[model samples]
Target: MWDKQVMKPVSEPANSPSYVQVRLKLLRDIATGVWPLGGRMTLSDLEARYGVSQSPVREALLRLEGDGVVVLHPHRGAVVPQVDAALLTQVYDIIGALQGMLARRAVDHLTRTHLRELEAHLARFDAALDGGDIVGAVAANGAFHGMLNSLGGNPQAKALIETRFALAQATRRLVGYSSGRTAEVKQQHQSLLAALILGDGEAAAQVLVAHADTARDDLIARLLSKGAASTAS
Candidate 1:
């Protein structure tokens, strides 16, 4: 049975930019695990499901491919890229390195305005957690990290981090950490933002590393528990 909570609404973005709307819907589905890892995604299926023309779906798939969320298989069509434990570890390590560098650099450049924006994001996250809004929590989490990367000022690094973050989203969702650890995750974000505000690169990096480590541990434990339960059943 498909979990309804996993079936996120595919709402059109404001202004309803045709191509972007299609792309956003597809990305949302992938992020929410509606399109599970290694699952095939057919153009025809997307076109029928999204009620969009083939062109937009194709473009979206191409974009997702570039982001490492989808792989173009010669004989198999587009499939959600699988991240094994080794690969997941590698990706998170890279994420920690890139984000550490970015945050360190950003501390020197983080403006008062930027800090205010980050604080607002944190507030939103807190509100979402208090209200038990999982979807809102996810969105705020993305916004907070996105703002951090954007403020870091290296477009190339930012692009890579964005891709890695998307991959992490899939992993996080699969392990049920995306919403379940909201309070702990929000606190980590607050700590990182504080380090950034104080222009403490070392502190910021340490916080981020800890944050990533916590996520990795949670994911591993969750997957192991699921496997054990499945075997017993």
Candidate 2:
């Protein structure tokens, strides 16, 4: 049984592969700050942590490594990247451009169904933020973009966006989320949706790019603040 401090664990989908289940759980743990950046988890420790065997754990780490979230040592363990300013800037830069690309393409293919789905995601985001559920809000926010990205119908671009998810999660977990940004996020989403509805791909892309830049800037500020605080302490 998970300890009391732990939130209820995410249940794996039925018949999922063992390694995939391990990977999801591992990602969740890392994203939630169970391990600090640059922390090492040896093969045995990971096997124990997730209550799985070595085979699946190794495979899972390989996948995360490929996604640029972890580094593997020969015959040893994995380490979460000790992210720096340059790395953060580079990752968010790529993420922003890809999201803008997808948002623009998303406009050309919108249907009533897709719009409704996007609205539902927005509602979920508002509710989460209202309740001060930062984790929930973040999850909903990801779902919102993920749905919009899908509507773009470019699997390659969508796949590239996903590869950055773990690294993005790490930055958010480290710097923390801001309710202060709520209004801006909501407005951006609303404006992007309106642009998509109006079939203005360029407008939607611009809004998305701006939205991404705003997010990146906020995280950078928070990250610097945390470092300063730690030094003072």
Please report, in order, the local distance difference test score of every candidate based on alpha carbons. 0.72, 0.78
lDDT of 1 at 7: 23
Q: Tell me the spans in candidate 1 whose CA falls farther than 4 Å from its real position.
A: 1-29, 46-68, 178-183
- How well does candidate 1 match the true structure in TM-score terms? 0.74
Which parts of model 2 have CA positions greater than 4 angstroms off?
Answer: 1-29, 34-36, 48-53, 178-180
For model 1, how does the per-residue alpha-carbon lDDT over 111-154 read when each residue is reduced to its tens digit?
Answer: 67778988998898789768866556667877887778766666
TM-score of each: 0.74, 0.80
For model 1, the run of ten residues with the poorest summed lDDT: 1-10
- Give me the candidate number with maximum lDDT: 2
